[model samples]
Target: MIKSVNCTSFKIERLQTDNGAEFKNTFLSTFLEGCGNIHETSIPYEHHQNGNIEWMDCSISEISQTMLIASCLPKELWPYAFCHAAWIFNRTMHGNDTIAPYEVIAKNKPSLLLLCVFGSKGYLYDHLFQKDLSEKAIFGYHLGEAPHSKGWLFWIPDRKKVLKGASVKFDKNCFIQRIPASTSSLSLIQASSIFDGSMILAIEKQDKLVSSVNVSHDPIHVTPINYREALASAEANEWNIAIEEELTSIN
Candidate 1:
């Protein structure tokens, strides 16, 4: 909370939250007291006290769900979808605002040139892992912009990991699909269909990106649930960089 507060340009005189143990802790109280900020709590189960945040949460949830349904990606990837939805929501103009909320907070305009559809077909070029005469690129689904670097973020179903890459190509015509079986392969189906209010031409590519095709039907891992998990992850370096970038952006 202190780190987040320090990033903001404005001074916080008072902070209000629910009567959760996370907020009513000694550690948080000590920090807030040292900062000379007042801490207040609303009655338990009284969600309307935080009306603005509640509305924002509902909006984000709806947007994320719609994105997942359109992409046909599993609900396990909802975190990425939620992040993408929030990113879009922050950049959009709301109410009587002339500029976006991001512009107001960051003091700069957000660019939409690199924005692509969620779960779009992506190809990550593998320079180190590819063998001679082997396929140079592997298929994945586009998640969003990389939080750490200027590259794009992708979810490779085959590797069961999230990665960031600069040399990534996206085929917006194709969408990701999950296979139920253990083995997975990409296939282009020939069909004329309407998807997400847009007319798709004949021979639409339905690339089956294998997420977690276990014989036991286990759940697929999406992302780290906490900082410790992120630090212990295979993409620990990337996550660390992302944490730094997030702090930098709020400042």
Candidate 2:
């Protein structure tokens, strides 16, 4: 974290932490000494001394709650929702002005075009684990934007992990909306058809570049899409990048 801070325009001065052994270890002390930073330890059991972090935690927790209820996604995904909320908050306006926190921190204007709806389902290519294009990419739910990336974060259920990549194929036609599984068996059939992208061509007026799949309900929130549809939406270059990430991962 300090290394990242140093890479930015700001020079290290002081860092404060609660009484945690990880922050007080010999290796950490040596590193802090090398960086010429002053380390301040907060009083034991006095969390109020860290009001800034406490407030930040509370704020993120509230945001997480709102998103979980609004999206009807599982509560286990609170961490992902919190991360997404913070990403949106950092890039978008905070005060009565257009300037954002990201701009202030990075000294550059943050682009809004990269933003996606929170808890929305999106697909990512599976070039790495999958042997060939015959299978195409994997599907996932949008967690938030990838840090230091034009890409987005997604929860990969099979691995039980979150992955960030530029290859996220987002299609609005996808079902992040409410669809109770017990309502109808036809809904399940409909879900399968949507995953196969049969409904996209039949329903929508215009041809979407990609037709997002309907495996939408998960603890992690995911939607898969067809590969052919992805090729058109992702464009050649971005698609290539996705393929490359897979290849690299496999190698």
Candidate 3:
């Protein structure tokens, strides 16, 4: 749970849960209370009070399951599918927000250009220093992206470890499915994208049973507009070269 919390980019303010003894313990109670947080308990037999979160959990589960099934991956990989769902759920437009949760927190427009179908087959170029032209690359499954380094993460069978790198080519046609935009699912997707007090308020009011551990975000790093400018400059240079070639050909 602590590890999960540290993975987020938000500081949990208050916590609310059902009347579970696990949550009513002295250590957790004292810890949260001492930290000046309001810990509220739900009324007995009050599942509706926590409907929002329950619904969100269901949505995440469904998304994870769908991804796994779509990719024909094993059941043991449900956790990875969950992580992928969460990642996509955050980047997707939520409710009224014009931007994604990643954009709101990172303070930049999130780019989906690097996104690959979850669990799709991918290849990473070989880094081997061998002089002979041996096998140039290895095959792997696209796991997810690194939160810190923004590097691509892959599950390499040969390596039996998750590897991170920037160079990767993906075969996304393996698994192609869409997240249906329904009323409830849309709300959950958008609401979960938020990390501000607004989201907490919504969860607390529902008396949700989750110790959503959110971590503090480090820094906001955005690709400068100069990148787009550079693309335009390159296009202009190519046009000039084309024009000069045409004139030289005519001469």
Candidate 4:
């Protein structure tokens, strides 16, 4: 969970969880204590205390399940569908918010250029295992976005494995019929329309559960944005020495 937000500048000061046995364990308690963080639990039998998270969980489940039903994919591929659902959830606007959660964290709007219909048929370049005379590209099903990458994940039925590929072409109009299912009842809009603008307030309330962890005596280091700032910073002497060394090496 910590790794999920490592890309951002947010510092986690507290953790809130339900009174599950997994969260009440000694190791987790000790870990939080070591990090000088607080751990709080929701009151027993009060589901409203966790309304935002509960609602989000339900939305993700519905979206993923809907994708599975539409794609006619097996239940075993639900993990990939969940990943795709989360990717979409982050990119999409929630409630009445003008900006997405991803925009808040990433400081920019997400690009939808690479997004395609779930279970869309595509061909992935097989540079790694391609024989001299074999086909360079192989057929596959669109899975989801690759973690920490700009590529997409593809499920090659022939190889029976999921492969990450950068260069690929998707046929948005074509969907694999590995398993046929009725997609009449499934709709992505249902997930987005379930909650109103009030849910944003509930999510903001949940944000109070986390805070910045900083000590008074700890010195904060701010990176210099430009050469002038670097010369005027507290480490100006070190910067000057480095600059002189670089000039000397160039000479």
Candidate 5:
């Protein structure tokens, strides 16, 4: 939940839960109150208001089940599998719509060159190296895209670790479909930019710009225009003689 809040651009104005004792605790209530957000409780049996979250949870459960059966991976690794699932979902086209969520937000279609087959084996080079000695790389699964950059993401199988916020460089010649021995561990990764109130405001501004442009008929032309071509015919006549003289000299 903290990670979700950290990654998203929207502020959670309130958190409404059921009359479950876990949520009704004094400490949790005090925390919510101190955060200056409303905390409302719904009736124990009625689930209509919380329908959205309920549906989302069910969907995740279904996806996890399918992935587990297809990949033969354990349930403990479902969280990592779900991250790859989300990346695929964000990139795939849906029902009569050619554009994906990534395209809509970035205003350009992202290339799939960075994508790797999920669960496929790959190698990840460690960041550090010893003097006059060749450093070793770890064997891992080619997961998906880096959340913050235009690169492939990997999950080191030997170490049972997921490499976040880092790019992968594939060795096409020696690529295989199995994990290898673990090497020296790499440094901990961090997000390049943290989500803040100001960044959320900026995203809102971008949304407005996209919405405004979507409704217009005129194409937003970004190509550079030649000054000579842009000039009126009458105005261009003044420069015609100069051009003619230059051409004649070449002839």
Candidate 6:
């Protein structure tokens, strides 16, 4: 599948694989070589040699399995399941570097405006509605992220819609599987309160005693903020200090 996509885009470069029977045939080697591509084989029994592909496959498998269990989806649709898995995984930030794969590749934070809870109830708008269409919304499982658009991929069982795009809604009751199983072991570090200087610390302090650290100064608030609230909270400390000074002067 990957080979087909690569061939279509004329981006076929080095095709690396383990010493498997699939790529051992002379025909496969000749075809790849004819396309001016290098077919490199990794060392036998040494999985670390092909760490990149190995890691990717493991990530996909883990995510797909989790989604399948969560949604009770069948095995035949594992391809779609993995696509959804890959999309979400890409959106997630890596623990080692604190950078999402999408951001790393695209060089920007992905917009979650169209993100919705996985396995949530949503209404699919029907275009061909002559009479008053009372029942528009259908029950669906929020699978993952979308490929082409800024929308949540929903699996609507009622309408038999698979991989449907929908708007993002933040309801407490919504069943969202935003936490992918592959990243379950990963830990997110929350920045603590900033001190007098611009030094930042994690909410959970590390045992290691480092002389100095340069943590991310970026704000990490997750709630959807209105313009007024956002502007007001921009200088949180300044507002508090000003209020304190006013009270002190009055007293």
TM-score per candidate, chains pooled: 0.66, 0.56, 0.57, 0.67, 0.47, 0.52
Pairs that clash in candidate 5:
none
Between candidates 5 and 6, name the one with more favorable lDDT: 5
Whole-model lDDT for model 6 versus the true structure?
0.53
Provide the overall lDDT of each model, using Cα atoms, as 2-decimal numbers. Answer: 0.67, 0.62, 0.60, 0.70, 0.54, 0.53
Mark the regions of model 6 whose C-alpha exceeds 4 Å error after superposition.
1-13, 19-35, 73-77, 167-251
Residue-level lDDT of model 4, residues 136-184, one tens digit each, is 9988888888777989888775555678888998876765576434422
Clash count for each candidate, listed in order shown:
0, 3, 3, 0, 0, 4
Point out the higher-scoring one by TM-score: 4 or 6: 4
Best by lDDT: 4
Name the 10 consecutive residues with the lowest summed lDDT in model 4.
209-218
Distance from true location, Cα of 224 in model 3, Å = 53
- Tens-place lDDT per residue, model 3, 15-90, is 7776543465455677787767788776544667777666666677788887887865444545567777888887
Which rank order by TM-score, best down to worst? 4, 1, 3, 2, 6, 5
* Residue-by-residue lDDT tens digits, candidate 6, 17-123: 86443454455667787878898777534678899878887877787777666754434445556676777777887658688877865667977665544344455
Error of 5 at 188 (Å): 22
What TM-score number comes out for model 5? 0.47
Estimate the overall C-alpha local distance difference test score of candidate 5.
Answer: 0.54
lDDT of 1 by residue, 196-250 (tens): 2131221121111111112222247434433554566677898788778756743
Task: List, residue by residue over 1-251, the lDDT tens digit for candidate 5.
Answer: 44545755546778987544345445566778887778877653366777766655555556655654465433445555666677666677766888986786556786777666555555676765444667566666665567667665666544546664343556556534322223322332311121123644654554444333322223462211222331323346544554566467434
